[model samples]
Target: MAAERVEKRGEEEAQTRLPDLSFVHDKLQKFQSKMVSDFEQRLSCMVEDVLQDLRQRELRAHEFPNFEKSDRKSTWHNRVTNQAPADVSDAPNGHANGTQPRPPLQSETSVRKQRRQLPEKVFVARESYLTALLQVEHMRTIYHIFYIILVMFLLNVICYDYFVDGRFDLGLGTFRGGLRRLHWVLGVWLLEHVFVLALYFAFRGWALVRHRLKPHSSLQRFWSHSCLILYISSQLVFCFVSTSLCLKFNLPFVSACVLLLESTRLLMKMHAFVRYNAERVLNGKAKKEDAQEEKEASGRPFVPPLSCYTYFLFAPTLIYRDSYPRTSHIRWKFALNRLLEVVAIAFLYAFIHERHIHEHFGQYGLEPMGPSQLILKLFGMMLPCAVIFLCGFYLILHSWLNFTSELLRFGDRMFYKDWWTSHTYDGYYRNWNVVVHDWLYEYVYKDMYTHVFRGSKVGASLAVFMISAVVHEQVLGFALQMFFPVMFFLFGVVGVALVFLMRSAPKVMGNIFLWFSLILGNATLISLYAMEHYALKNCSLSNRSWTDRLLPAVWRCYN
Candidate 1:
């Protein structure tokens, strides 16, 4: 009885020492709840203060437009302009570079319209998709696989030459042959650049002449008309001269390709420069009363620096702006890598043509084949042609453009998008070459819709398609020295039809169809063009006339 009583007393003492456990737990919970409530109250106050500050800033943005110089350049999505602000020190009558005065912001609708008409381009600091993707291990592996395939192709060429002739050879004869007359290509390109540069000074001189003359004076009017005539005549003459030189010089196919492509780029750049500045020149004439005010507002004359014009000529863009987002410094290593890829891809093209394209089609005109054999040839060419197409994309759009952009310290590097994943033709066309598509959209499609087609979207879209088709055909025709409308038919007719048909297709089905069409179309292009090229060489025409030159040589080969 004594021992049990002692144990009971010990337990009672321990419980007293522990204090009230439940009371302590309740107190802690109350403390946590109070802390949370206090935090919530403080956070709410902070958020409210931030909101008030934002509201004030927005109000100021509206009340004092001068505060928007920097913001205005960046506020719009994918749209930016290099025009001076309204309060700039040297704008002719408070206008930017003598640009037409902004209309009164009388209504919301008009404001929206004005916004739509703003320049539709923005340059932001960005790396290309492939450059970013290649940083990841898995994506880098895919790129490595392409290099491996190219190496395998080279080995195959070596083995073939060794087995046939009992001597090792690189089998690059066809490639070397095609790249002949490179010096001529370079010469023509240099000459074209000289002409393009001349245009800038010519326009600047005319602007100065106009700037000095009295506004609305008869002499100014005559000079303005003369300037218009000069622009038109110069452009036409440049086009004629460049094209005739390409044709008359009897340049090699590759030389012609370079000249033709460069010519198109120069023409587009020239037009963009003129079209943009012409508005500014005309605005000065229209707003003569505001000229003094603009001069007072701006610190200097409104002419763009020659450096800006020269930069645009080599920059990986077609749009003309006085300023663009730029990097702090050029990445020489990055530029070197891109240039190396260009060289490698050029070799890849030559190998593909020699092995798969030229070998099969070289004897096309000399030999006869049945329909089944022809179909087999067509199918066989599909994979090779698809590879060539992808290489070509990388060569011109990615590698070449990126090299130039890096060298120039251009910030916007989005020369293409994820076109391979596109499920619709419309998406593919838009994403394929963003640089060109942007030019077409801003200058061609929008202008047609607003001014020419009068709000007819269909007409504008059609115009865009037609222009693209014709230009594509022209390039190929000049390169091959033959007239073939296969590209035109595929691009303008079947491509458009597929776009509408696949507009709402299921994602899986649409993507499959898109790839199928691309492969098949590339196959068709390579086969037909190759056959025609060989046909012209191997087959003799009884009468070599201008019309005969336009006729399909492949048909004559069979006849």
Candidate 2:
């Protein structure tokens, strides 16, 4: 009886624990299998990433732009500028100085003889008077320039209508009434050079004084004065000449303004892109000692600045005018390269997290990440959105990183703004979304300074804002899949007005207003997010119901 009871107890215990053992066994098998799949997926993704890098490399190397064959008369290495005097022996370069004497005009027969006598002239590293200003170096300066332009443009336009004209149409017969008076008021002595001059002396003088308490070089003085001039001039052109032309031509004021703004913005970006090679690449590729110094100082392995360098890889092929080789453009090649990178990174992440997710699930194709794992994915989506939004906000916040990280650090933090609006404000936007900032500076502000307003800060500011608003709206629309960046700008312009007006007020009053603005700003942001999220969710669902349903099918196919 005792033995039977013991046996029965043992049997019961075994039965109770049997499922646990079986469960463990099944769990181990699932984990092993899933791990394998995840591992494979990771391998696949990595392979894809490498393939992408390789493809871009090959494309940029081969596709090079389709410039006319005649243009090939000047290879990058050869091609001498006509800087040299006419009767000189070939100084080392075999071309006399910077200028090469013009060969006599000839039909094809004489051309060959001249070619034999005078080889191509190359511009070597003549003394490194200045290193190429890489996009990274130029980004912040560019961004601030853009923001200044945007703000000035917005302010003038706002003041013209909301405050000056007050009303638009003249219904009754008063020749001097509504629209005409409004247009006059908007166009009138809205700008005078006196206050602008005061601003220039105060800011520029102070900057120079602080830098060295006395001007060291004519170049420094010239740079400061010109910078100030640019601000004033850009404002005048954007506010007066450009605006008047729009009215005279019956151009859509806002649309015309936006066009001016966007072109400059793009140009600014291209400038930064060009400068990157000037600053970082040329120096980086020079020698071993430089590479060691760059790594030690920057603490970034791989390239001198990995993120910024990536921009060149893509930008040289797609964005810049004369970069890369002609044979590189394969159809749909860029798209394929992007897809491959996505696969590699996705697979790598999934494989790493396999144990954390379902033990049995391996490479659940397109499986939505659970709460914990999802933050990274959400981060990627939100980052770009925030960047586009902040370009408008940069007009409002007036910082670099919230604006210009694309240039300084390159693509690494190209989509970040966390550093921009922290308490000090300096640390924030300065390096955050550098790419767009570069665009604004070179195309809008610098052009205005050197060519447009002749370095009038206020004018540059106005130009940048108009350009920034238009570009932001377009980029945001593409990113968020909606329209109304225009509305966003209206709100942003209002925000700018509030900020500047507050800055001008008495300290106590300004502080109060600033705090009030800050709180309102937070609430507005929350509201915008909720609105955008609701809109996106509804739209995505409406458009892709079948895909939502077929998720399981996708999983099966991938698995």
Candidate-wise lDDT, in order:
0.78, 0.40
Looking at candidate 1, the ten consecutive residues that score lowest on lDDT are: 86-95
Candidate 1 structure, TM-score to reference: 0.77
The clash count of every prediction, one per candidate, is 14, 78
lDDT per residue, candidate 2, 178-241, as tens digits? 1233343333323322332343344434343434423457865666567557655754554445
Task: Please write out the lDDT profile of model 1 over residues 159-220, one tens digit for every residue.
Answer: 87788767764645655576677787788789888888889898888887887888799999
In model 2, the runs with Cα more than 4 Å from the true position are 1-271, 274-311, 314-439, 490-492, 505-519, 532-559
Measured against the true structure, the TM-scores of the candidates, in listed sequence, are 0.77, 0.26
Q: Pick the candidate with the highest lDDT.
A: 1
TM-score of 2: 0.26
